[model samples]
Target: MQKKAGPFFYVFLALFVFFVMFPFLWVLLSSIKPLGELFGDKAFDWFTSHPTLKSYVSVFVNYPFLRYLWNSTVVATVTTVYTVFVAAFAAYAIARLEFKGKTVILGLVLAVSMFPQIATISPIYMFVKKFGLTNSYLGLIIPYTTFALPLSIWLLVTFFRKIPFDLEEAAKMDGATPMQTYFKIIFPLAVPGVFTTSILVFIAAWNEFLFALTINTAEKYKTVPVGIAMFQGQYTIPWGEISAATVIVTIPLVIMVLLFQRRIVSGLTSGSVKE
Candidate 1:
């Protein structure tokens, strides 16, 4: 006979799922509510009110929402692309190449990942200013890649280590150069890792608030997180508009996660599997 899940197991699972999803559901529901009805007195009034797209329209019309979205998309996409290429090569070297102090190098990479982004913000700002990169795509892109590289390299290394060296040897025997072998053989096999790293780097760059706020002073150059944060003032918070912006910024990420869910699962599982 098939075993049934224990009572407490089901209870805990339900609670966990609810805890994870409640905020997203609340935001989605709130996004569609009318401005006045959003914080109405009735407990479930927000749910019962007629929905409107005014807030969304106002966001696009009143602010440079499209500009911010475009900036974020460009930054995130470029960062993801650059990071994958650099990290994949670094990971391949660390995993497959015979090098001295590999353990020390890996440990240093981990240490860099552990360093909080805030701790280096001042230095990063100074560097950006020195290069006249502030408010430019390069400004955000450089920092995003720096912060993202460590984790991306580490994860790719883990995945690359699982791939057999015999594949590389076989490719070399067929007169394939190292670059050709990596491009033709290893890269195709490392799709799961590439997808995982790209998604993470994109999300990090997309949702980054602190650096974007500090570096990109122009409203047109600001990312979604910074744009969302500036959606209200002290005296009157436009909850409707804020909710609408939240929904707008959230949809792309949600779609990306859904589309690459299988690759994400495979990447996570790859880390656990040995050869």
Candidate 2:
């Protein structure tokens, strides 16, 4: 039997939800408000006296926001696909095959993930510049993949390790080749983990700011974050427009998480205990 939550539990949960959601609520409010009301004395009011979609419309009309969205979509989608594909193979090898220096390799992957992006940015920028990839999709995609791989690999290794070795043995007994066994039997069973990793990597790539800003300086290649950050004026900042753009950028991620949340939860928990 399970115990029911008391008043204190409900209070704490409500408070925690509010604490996590207040920033988004504030941004949403700001997006709907007119510039004067957004910046003026009634800025913190819970409801705006006059809510308008002018800011949202201006985002599309005055700027190349659609192009930025498209750029972000392409970069993030490609990065997630490439990172998960490579991580899948690397993780399968690490989890199933016996190899020397396996521990060292895993440790190195963790170390690379923990390495400060700021510390490595200069060299990455130089490398991209040397390859003449700057101001291009590949420029951002490469760095995003580098940062995204370690976590994806780690999560996938956990999932792959949880798959029964007997399955592989059975496939081999049936005269299936190694590639056939992996693609047919092992990979399908690990789909939940793969989906989870792809979502995380995609979100990271979409929201990445520093590498996008540094590597893709041209207006045509700028992503959502870089484009949003570049929103400015000679006399004042366009807070309403900025907020509107932020809301627009965040909606897709929210919808994705909501739709696939069950898979994400199951994927994360499935590998926690050995069968």
Candidate 3:
């Protein structure tokens, strides 16, 4: 049996958690503080004497924040769903099937994933504009899916390889067709990987700022990231409102993680066996 954690472990753990959570804690504290207290002499204080939900109210009351939220949700969800659907099949093939130049293909996928978004943005923007797809959800969705796929494919490839081929052989012996085996046996067992992939892809797409700002020009098409940027006044930034919006947008992610924490942990930690 492993020994229990020592005092040093608890001290390090507390420090790690504090540093990791400090930014979010600050944002949370700032969101509830009254503007006068937040910007006034008491700004340095940690606790707020006058805590209120006014900034959160301003988030919805003063702006079309919900529409921006819907835009982000639609784009992120579409990108995640499409990327996972395509990546699952692709990864399965790479992991299980015999094929030529498989190494080269995987290398190319990794190369594509490594290419900076800045390098591709110009071409992508021009192509979208040429096709009159600018300032639309589709424009963002397509690019986001493209960028997310390479990593998703790589992740699923590792996961698919971890699954025992004996399972596949058993399914085949049971008169299960190849497609049925894949759909029924492999996919279900790959749930941990899929759940993990969806979370990463959704978070990437949801929090992406440069692409959202570059591809979507219309105010109505703007996502939460870009919409939050609009909180800047001509000369002054609305810190409280920005903090509130940050909190609002973060709730969904927090909820998703809470809901799928088990799968995420399993996905990251699985695959210890050897043939």
Candidate 4:
């Protein structure tokens, strides 16, 4: 039998929800506010006197927001796909096959993930510059993949270790090649881990600001976060426009997370559980 919830639990939960949601609500409110009220003394007003879509309109008219969205989408998608693809094989190798220095390799992958991005910025910039990849899709994609791969590999390796050994043996007895067994048996069973890793990688690449800012000097190649930061006026900052742009870019992420939230929860929990 389960105990009934008390009023205190509901009260605490409400407070926690409000605490977490206030910033998003504030930003949402700011996006629709009239520019005058947004910047004026009424800036902190909980509710707006006048709400309009003018700021949203201004964003598209004044900036190439769509191009920024496109650049982010392409870079993030490519990064997630490439990182997951490479990490899948690497993880499989680490989890299933016997090899030398396997523990050392796993430790190294984790170390790379823990290494600060700030520390690598200068060297990465120099390397990318030497290859003339600055202000290009490949420039960001490569670094994004590098940062995302380690974590993805670690997650997949841990998840793969949870899978049954008999699955592999069964496929082998059916005259399946090693590659066939992996693709047909192991790979299909690992979709949850793959999806979870892809979500994390995609979000990290999509919201990555420092790398995007450093690698792309041209406005045309700027991602959404960088582009939103660069939106300004000679005299005063356009808060409404910035908020509107932020809301625009943030909506897709929110929707994506909402739709796949169940899968994400299940994937993460499944990976964490031990047999």
TM-score, structure 3 vs. true = 0.91
Task: Tell me how candidate 4 scores on lDDT.
Answer: 0.88
TM-score each candidate: 0.89, 0.91, 0.91, 0.92
74-180: candidate 3 lDDT, tens digit per residue: 99889999998999888898998889988888888888988889988998899889988898988998888657898788778888888999999999899999899
**Which of the two, 1 or 4, has more TM-score?**
4
User: Model 4, stretches more than 4 Å misplaced?
Assistant: 1-3, 232-235, 265-275
lDDT of each prediction vs. the true structure? Answer: 0.84, 0.88, 0.86, 0.88
lDDT accuracy of residue 34 in candidate 4: 88
User: Cα lDDT for residue 15, model 1?
Assistant: 97
Native-vs-model 2 lDDT? 0.88
Backbone N/Cα/C clashes per model: 0, 0, 0, 0
lDDT of 4 by residue, 1-275 (tens): 89899999999999999999888889899998888887659988988878899999999988999889999999999999998999999999999999899999999998898888898899899989999999999999888866899978888898788789999988889999989989999999988878887887788899999999999979899999999988876887888888899899878878988999986665566545775
Model 2 ranges with Cα > 4 A deviation: 233-235, 263-275
Evaluated at residue 134, the lDDT of candidate 2 is 99
How many pairs of residues collide in model 2? 0
Residue range 141-256, candidate 2, lDDT tens digits: 89996689987887788888879999999999999998998899999998877888888778888889999989999989999999999998778899999999999988876898
User: Superposing all C-alpha atoms, what RMSD in Å does each candidate have to the true structure?
Assistant: 2.7, 2.3, 2.5, 2.1
Clashing pairs in 3: none
